[model samples]
Target: MLSVHLLTLIALVTSAKAAISPFTSRPRLQTTFSGLSDVEPFSLRLSPDTAKVCNSTTPGTSGFITADDGQGGNNSIFFWAFESKHDAKTDPVILWMSGGPGASSVGYGNLMELGPCRIASEGGYTVDNEFGWNVNATILFVDQPVGVGYSRGQRIPTGLRDSSLAMLRFLRQFMTAFPELADRDFYIAGESYGGSWVPALASTILRSESRSSGQRGALMVQEDGPNLSPNSRRGPKINLKGIMIGNGLVRRSVQNIGFFETVCSGPASLFNSSQCLEWAPRAMWCEDNLAVCEVDGMKSSACKDAESKCSAISKVVVEDMHLNPYDFRRECHDPDSCYSEMRHIDEYLNRSDVKMALGVPENEPFVGISLDVFKQWEEVGDLWRASDEYVNHLLQSGIRVLIYVGDKDLYCNAAGMRLLVDRGLSWHGQPIIRLRELVPWYLGTKSAGLWKSYEPLTYAEVAGAGHLVPFDKPEEALTLINSWIHGRLPAL
Candidate 1:
């Protein structure tokens, strides 16, 4: 009694699985880069790690890379790399993350979004994703912030700041192990909570890079000294190019302005007028609380108070309407399964063979999304506040930033993202204004979306897509990414 569409989905899933075998005979963790000769001050080798050939057909590596946890202990940050189909030596290195504050990039970014392959819905096999983003650039999907996935650590990070620092340590060590990647053009990309994560990490890197002064092939990480400028301090630098964030939560205050618009008058009329009317008072109340929170220090109780008040709008919608916060077209199925593929990814990653192949511990269970991490952030009042400052910092410092959204998303909709960028951003003490008119973006013969640019900042909206833009519009997403990295608008 399966519907025609459902039957077709199963057939495609089965056929796709046949194309990509779950196990590969090729040696694991092989790198195509020419070996490093010169040693750098910050360079340190990663150890106590195990790796294997996880996929024969897929190129590049998958393993846990050890990073110093800022504490004495070492934390494992899980990574899966899809080496570029083009020249690995010159192509850009793109690191991807999916936001949950606790989400697994290996699960959401890899298995569900832009990885070279995907897990079958029932979780028994793997399938080739032709639209994977590794076509021209090396893509590394990292499970970050510790305790998110295959990554393990003695302590869990409390918030974005801690998570960003851990990631910085991990990146340094990871690049050192594969020294050839150090000089390549690097980019950080993520979504959702990653809105905060991407900019925070980018700012940290920029700050470090600015203070370092290195000549020839040597770099040093300064531990302590009088603060110096970029020309004075001598250390290594990540060859950062730009960042791309998909439907991210940039500034909650700015985004909240568009919340009522989307919920009440969105294309689908997802909420009744009576229900929508009830939110006006709550929205105003939250706004007043948020204003007070903004003036209060980052760690002040007022911030937590504001976070609690503003969060109710979405909470009530989720609790009462039962709509998937990510998309208006579907009902959220269950508490355990937030998105459609959560269960499938959990099953695929936890399989004994799969774990052995990827060098994950056999005993530790895999969690697609860690509710514990989520709760921890809530407890510490880390969810609210704004990332516009970081974004502005990046722009003023010449780091290109792209914010793209799926028009169908209910949670972080295009309207909200547009509001965040157009109204919420400022650079060099001046408010950011659009440099170009919003225009149709093309993918082949069809109009895929709309895009507008403001020099280092660009805002895009993808048609027929939801919160998880890449998963909802793979081909268009790939095209959009390629265009962004290549310094061209996606017109083809």
Candidate 2:
């Protein structure tokens, strides 16, 4: 599927490797500040033979491990930093987190999608990728919650709600381990469920910094109380310039109920024969649609052979597929067709050393989490909501929050994202229009539209991208991110 021009760009970029030092016999432990005796200094040795597949022109490897503060916890945080061939010292740091309160960052965020090096099926050699994010920034692909990636932890929490606690401990350990990065300008970015993690972590860092005079200050107090400091406070009061969430799941209640009905109801009515299908109803219609047409999920005997004539519903079953109440794709959709692209990406991910560094097993099952974890995740789904207070706190502090959505992703589509932004942002009247256009600039032949509109915060739709924007349009994504960081709204 890669074009000749893209392949040519890859070839051009793949041959350059002088930007990064060759693997040394000793690890490189470059520190910035002194007087941190409690923390042990460590160096990183990048695998020399590892191929750089993301950009064919930049000769680079896949992974490197960095030490981080676990924050009073016994576990140590280890992160994978992807360097750019352009320049390391001056390059901005883009910290990437993948969604999945339980997914591996290196697997999903790095090798398969955004980071500099992607996994190549041939000989494990790295190729240059023209669309890699490293053309402008140094990406730190992190696996949080301890037991993630190569980082070790005593226990994996059974529910998704425990993600915040895990991240707090991880950030503490991460900062402690890499005291050198304490003052770097950083941006927290992610996709899917990470919509929650990025903002929550940013807020945590801000609160942590607000407490003390210097970087090592005490955690900030919560908005509510004096003695009972909620699990919210922890981490550095980061000079967090901005945040980007692609296809995130931060506004759960509104997204699932309000947006779901609006976009899917019309399609559902086209396939279902039941007159019971009324707009704005607070119930799911699986049986009516199945009785009328061959809708996938409602084929059980309960809907079969019933002479209850119903209207034919469309074959598109987005909501039911998501709310199947099961983590297994087989339980939700036709296994033969469900996640075919994801499975291919997974195949490449399993074979990469980048994945190994993140502690994701090559042969691990598609549904990585245990059944107990899934059940707990369901019970605690509400915990992922980002409160109005937190959003307000950031805006009050002048932090820029950018929430982006991929129109094609059923799980966290643009419609849901728009609803969330409208609800959270306090903008009166029509939101300020920053920029907009359907342009042809990236590798793809038919160009996608790019819109940059802001009202203190900016929300835009990255056309043609799925749940993962970078994977779908890496060059455009990188360009947009670079423009935003530089305080310039992108012009489509």
Candidate 3:
């Protein structure tokens, strides 16, 4: 059975805590900000065991940016914008979000994947990740749509429209908060349900009415306050350069085709060909139901049935096969998060001192995935609708996009992502990408992944990696991203 917060959402937005023992919280002092206006860099002590020998500096600014929750009052979106280890002024900014419709980016994206620090599971401490994404870019890991992670909102994230708008409002506030980094090239990235988030936010940014160079927006002082007046601060347009998705879920029906192939006939199939054949009929039913739901409302009963049945397929793998949905290589220890390391991360983030340093609300629990966020999203049947059309919009706008998947993932499997890239996504570049073949992309003379690109859109598959590619293959993940941002992925 699934744990309360542990149902899908990718890594978190859930309720389970790690069951590890003997690792008690160690107290450490950290600078706290009184307001959302402060942008001074803050540092955290890395290790508690050997403070002197292993202590390292992880410099970043953490705080909340208030937005209007659709229900009135205000929504506080928490973000940790980590400074680039290389160049703070000139390096690109990467805004990273986690999926699950309710998952916290802090758990899945930052502490686990490309963040500067990695939390140790055994001793419940921290270590510097030399391959952190901050090595070349300023990465902001946001716990958004209001109630995820350290953020406390007036209500749960109800739908994609609301969540994306909140993200836009958060970015406006983010620009006002950090003017020094305003004009820097910005890119958005996410995984799982973030597939829906990344494109929606990008599209909203493209579609928002305020596109002028000189635009100032008001700021709300409190979490339960009214709208910002004209006497506040400035918010410049984001220099949104590109988008990157790791093991993303874009097209529901097309990805369904990929799912069947992943388990049945793909290069990384977990089930035998004969075993996969038995499940083919249900896959077809899911695809048909989703098609009908698209014509009916996204929240229609037909769509709900399809969503329920499709989820049952994954339930089989998790329950009967005893494998994690994010990464089949691991056992599903926690229902929502699928990994025990997530529990340690949960325990670490909830530590009093850590919360104090981050200036999180004293009582707000650090949920990996909020069941509240998930239930609200599902009730509306929003999960079945596809976001690939938004991907096409980004491509047409001349913004670059990188879609990389971990081969071992089950939920947003590599095969499905590839299928979406090939014929599933509807764009002018669709035909161009469909005809191209994936060539080997090397990591120091050894093959790490297969990639094919035609500018604006680059699709790759990370070898042996799972749902969270950066978490499973940090070095390769970094190399893939650094290559994509700086230049094309070199064949040599």
Q: How many clashing pairs per prediction, in order?
A: 3, 41, 13
lDDT tens string, model 1, 277-388? 8778887776556656557744687776777777776776677778777876778755346665777887777888777666566798777778888887777767665788
lDDT of 3 at 355: 71
The TM-score between candidate 3 and the true structure equals: 0.83
Q: Where's the lowest-lDDT run of ten residues in candidate 3?
A: 1-10
Give one digit per residue, the lDDT tens place, for model 2 in 366-446: 232123333445455333434434555666677777777665555566655766666534433124332232233332444
Better of 1 and 2 by lDDT: 1
In lDDT terms, how accurate is model 1? 0.70
Q: Tens digit of lDDT per residue, candidate 3, span 291-330?
A: 6655776777776777778777777788888898888878
Minimum summed lDDT over a 10-residue window in model 2 is located at 1-10
TM for every model, in the order presented, reads: 0.83, 0.65, 0.83
Ranking by TM-score: 3, 1, 2
